[model samples]
Target chain A: MAMTEMRKDDDTALDLFFAEARQSAPEPSAVFLGRILAQAEGVQAGFCATPVQPAVRRGVRAGGLGMLLALLGGWGGIGGMATAAVAGVWIGFAGSDTVAQVAGYAMTTETATASALLADGDILALAAE
Target chain B: MALDALDDVSDETLLVLYGNGDRAAARMLTLRMGPLAFRVAQRMLGDRAEAEDLAQEALLRLWKIAPEWRTGEAKVTTWLYRVVTNLATDRLRRRRGIGLDEAPELPDGAASAVEQMIDGDRAAALEAALAQLPARQRQAVVLRHLEGLSNPEISAAMEIGVEAVESLTARGKRALAAILAGRREELGYGHD
Candidate 1:
């Protein structure tokens, strides 16, 4: 009975102490919620991708494409080699444009078209229309 | 142990449930402990934006660890508080290299003078008092009083012994009360 009474008293004191302390201040606003959620999303994405192998997926897709391209080249001879060389150069240039766009989006203003398309053609076509 | 009688379950149990993919447990734990965690981070860092981020990060980490959480170990909330405290300390350390700025003042509310007067600058005063304490002392005060943890629980949270918790809480409270009490007349806190 005495132990129980002591426990009750201890609980009461703890309650009162916290009650007084909780009167300190209010919480952050909904704006703060948006900020934290954005951060949480970034952290979650990083955690989710940690153990997954992007290389495996890329390897499977690339292997199939390589096999098909090799078959077409073998059948077409010189024409096929020319086509493949042109395609590779064109792809390299296209990849460069894409990398520029992404880097621009991350480092600078995404809305800036000049930065979004450092290469001449993509924006020139957009402008022509 | 009584389900119906459980006003609030400890963070450890909530953690175990959340780890097991109990969405209800996760939500309950967040709502139950979010305010306390946020307050502790805010008090320690003196920056609302950073504090909010730190609190969310701490909780997210808790969620990530839930799947592997062991029972009969440290209380979940204590672990969370420790994470928050450590994160806040890191922010402070980083700020030292990058010159920490004064916290931006919050916008004033549209309440009447009486209401404003009652709430007038109390938050500001509390923030100032919190800024004056050492990081560990501030954590002790916030954990014991504001966060409502027992000394033993605080020891577990702070990774210190119960006696150390007691010493820190006493010193912290005395310092905080002294700071707040000093501004009582100027801020009109003692009038009512």
Candidate 2:
């Protein structure tokens, strides 16, 4: 048919155009290629500069002390616990008399005055009345 | 590995090596894929400068993805083609109001004077007609005929169904045939 032949001719014409287009495909300039390569190198360098570190595993394998520390919330918790232990040990070594003296010094003025009154027999007179 | 030594190496292997911090692999991939990305971008966007920028951006994306590139998965060329076409489409969308007359002429820089005159005329004529097509048609035609991508490959690149790709290419070729029918003799194809 004439229509079929005409279609075939059109296909051939289009094919030639496509071939010419392919032959004349635009190429990147050397400078453009260089810039791309440099960017690649830079990106690769970034990966090298910041290697991913393995995650730190936790739990019993960290040892009993470490586990306790972790449970108590790390170094900050350990500091608070150490301070309390040291205070307890100091109080035990200081004896009850020393503790009483320190407690007396820490008492309010009203309590101190009441203690003085009891020591001076004021409490005994009030008791007789 | 040396650059030449990577001649037999697959793109996936090159990407893996690049991921492992091999500079030579990076160079090899750049050498091999950069032109492909550029050519596609150039055909999609008729401006040399815009095409160059788009190509660079696409390849930069490739570099960033190199570390996470999974071997034995998608081909690198397929990924690059998708990136270039998508980016070019976005740019074309932004230039919606611009007329076809505003498109900068593609340069004829590679050939000698006489050869350049003849081939450049044919290339320019085809490119001008290509620019007249709807964005999707131009993309389909360029990828199929010019880039020689198969329907399945173009389907993947354009993220469309294979049947849709077939339809677009068929329509595109017909449109191109009509556009260029008047110029066959001038382009040395002789009158129909």
Candidate 3:
């Protein structure tokens, strides 16, 4: 029992020291606090100053022609459609006789032109007048 | 937010505000946590300059982490305590060869007015004894006794179980008592 009391006494003594230590806890200098605050401000400034770049909405906003090209499967598809259109115009203007001539069949352009002029005699009359 | 309005704000709230780039919150958090970080660093490292450096580094990390700080996930003080202890432990490990006799002398201006109010000799004696302890024991004892952190808080700060904290503190107190036994009369604790 006496030994336990002695231990208690030692504990009490240590507690006093601990108390003193707490009371005497160090205070950081103003310079130290200022430095910390400065660092915080610098970091906060970094957060504010950086701008979040808006995502570039590429290809979707291209106007009417761009939309049309896109609908036609872009440049490659548009090029194919353009070629088909040119060929159709050529076939419509040159007629079947011209196509047959190009295929090495004997055909005259004058005969085809004369027949077209006869079918549209009003155009020939207008030219004569 | 106004600086005056932040007086009643919680640390986590202040951190969130600081994350949002609120200058008032930054000031408030620095004022609240800077001294705490320094005090614990000083206790653990026993050098004012070194303590200030460690405390600054810890607070810098806190600022850097502000944007990602998850409120309600952990207490701010607990995190700071853990960081300061870890940094001090790393420093102590690197300083393994340095003897206690080589401990830096306290500068003449190092003692503050509050330190003067206490028995400076007693505080010094206690500090010397604390310096003699193993790093973990000293950390446990200082946090438990001097800093008044509860076992669970110490456990969180030290990243150990509560039972382990209790064991460390018990052992630390016994060791401190043994180290300071001969100095009781010198420290005017002879009557006790």
**lDDT values for all models:** 0.63, 0.83, 0.84
**Per model, how much of the real contact set is kept?**
0.19, 0.87, 0.90
Winning model by lDDT: 3
Query: What does candidate 3's lDDT look like per residue over B12-93, in tens digits?
Result: 9999999998999999999999999999999998899999999999999999999999878889999999999888877886
Please state the CAPRI-style docking class of candidate 3.
medium
In angstroms, give how far residue A10 of model 2 lies from its true place.
1.4
Better of 1 and 3 by lDDT: 3
Q: What is the DockQ of each candidate?
A: 0.09, 0.66, 0.60
Segments in model 1 whose C-alpha atoms lie over 4 Å from true places: A1-21, A30-129, B1-13, B94-120, B177-181, B188-192
Tens-digit lDDT string for candidate 3 (A1-129): 498887898899999999988999999999999999999999999989969877646765467887887788988998999999999999999899988777653356655666676657766786789
Model 1: per-residue lDDT, tens digit, A1-129?
496664454444434434544785558676655554454444444544547654544323456666775566544665868888998897797888886787878766645745565667866877889
TM-scores for every predicted model: 0.52, 0.73, 0.73
Best by DockQ: 2
The fraction of reference A/B contacts recovered in model 1 reads 0.19
TM-score of 2: 0.73
Q: What is the lDDT of candidate 2?
A: 0.83
Across B1-192, the per-residue lDDT of candidate 2 in tens digits comes to 788899999999999999889999999998999999999998989999999999999999999998898877789999999999889877886776654334333223212222333443888878877776667778899999999999999999899999999998888787777767667766788753
Pick out the ten consecutive residues of candidate 2 chain B with the lowest summed lDDT.
B105-114
